[model samples]
Target: MPFKASGRATDYRAIDRFDGGAGWIAHPEETMQRASHVLRASGGEADGGAWVVDPVNADGVDDLLAEFGDVRGVVVLMDRHARDAAAVADRHDVPVYVPSFVDPDVDAQTQPLGGTLPDSDYEVVRTVDWPGWDEAALSDGETLVVGDAVGTTEYFRAGGERVGVHPLLRVKPPRALRQFRPERILTGHGEGVLTDATRALQDALDGARRNAPEVWLNGLKALV
Candidate 1:
């Protein structure tokens, strides 16, 4: 789906929140549509350093920092998903990592996502030739964290059931993402897949491939 203006967007309330074993994900209220995530190294690393992804609620900042220990980095998945990132970064005195292709409108200083993560636990992959946005995802070999280049809203189910790509993204799934065999997927929108992540990703890609017309129509609507 095209990015809807925030004015028309519903306020998200938390629905599900948990540590995805290897990582932590906080689902936005009510909808499995969006979330704030923290990617950390195994064994909790001594420094507790972590990368924050597309944070939304400022009221929960203290709790997030507490859980993650220290914010080594703040990342905005796409320009549209920069919500609360500036505030969160400023609160922790860290730089916001954005895609290199577009100018970030947030107040904080911005750095390119590449090789900027506090540790090597995560890698940023930019989605090339994506329509109307410069998008990216964070991967740690076993997990993939994303804002919206891919999503699970369309396929969401109760009890943390696995979901597929955002309806809009089914038109053109990025090959960069397809290459990763993530065991879990932490998504900005949609409840995350805590199990069978690699298979879930492949399923999402297959669903997109089968829904080419729906994807094309969504893309055209965004243009109009």
Candidate 2:
């Protein structure tokens, strides 16, 4: 589907709240909302009440909300710096939990999904996934928020290889799942949501990388 936060024009205003929001990513990809992330506050009573922080480009975030409603528990599938997810947590006043590889400052954070959120201003809650925490499963929505691990700009990369050409739509490597069967994927840059061509690519990549161990090893190797 075309980018739309429920038909709302791509909103740069939401991008202004993060650490160096709009200007943080100065690369050419940055011009098109690269490195930007998706802010998702968790909901429902059965699951943790925290939010999901997937760093997607402007269009991805917008279309994601439109397709699946607000996110309620952050799931970071990559280790790339996710545009200061803590700031996003603070914006919604929720806890931020990211993958361990994300290199976050968990000492300053907490779990937002749980109601025990401290009275103090929002801090980070870096979950540092030692085991797989499919927080997205908590939501009735099938949408998964995978920071930069999933969608990204056309030519966005640090070393000189754009991930679009890489085997998987992944970055910062070291993956766990052999394939991501997200009904809808919100990329941080380039085309935000994946439904048609992007969806087909996701399926193909998932099938090729069924060797979870090798896929993760390759991803980590690429980053290292």
- Using all chains and alpha carbons, the TM-scores for the candidates as numbered come to 0.75, 0.42
Model 2 Cα shift for residue 59 (angstroms): 16
lDDT per residue (tens digit) for residues 84-151 in model 1? 78887988898998877655578898887664355656777775455576777777677777777566
**Per-residue lDDT value at 140 in model 2:** 19
Q: What value does the lDDT take at residue 196 in candidate 1?
A: 81
Least well predicted 10-residue stretch by lDDT in candidate 2: 17-26
Q: What stretches of model 1 exceed 4 Å from their correct place?
A: 1-32, 41-43, 155-161, 211-224
Residue 41 miss distance in model 2 (angstroms): 6.0
Model 2 shows how many backbone clashes?
Answer: 25
lDDT of each: 0.62, 0.36
Worst 10 residues of 1 by lDDT: 20-29
Error of 1 at 100 (Å): 1.8
Off by over 4 Å in 2: 1-32, 35-77, 105-107, 112-141, 156-178, 197-199, 202-224
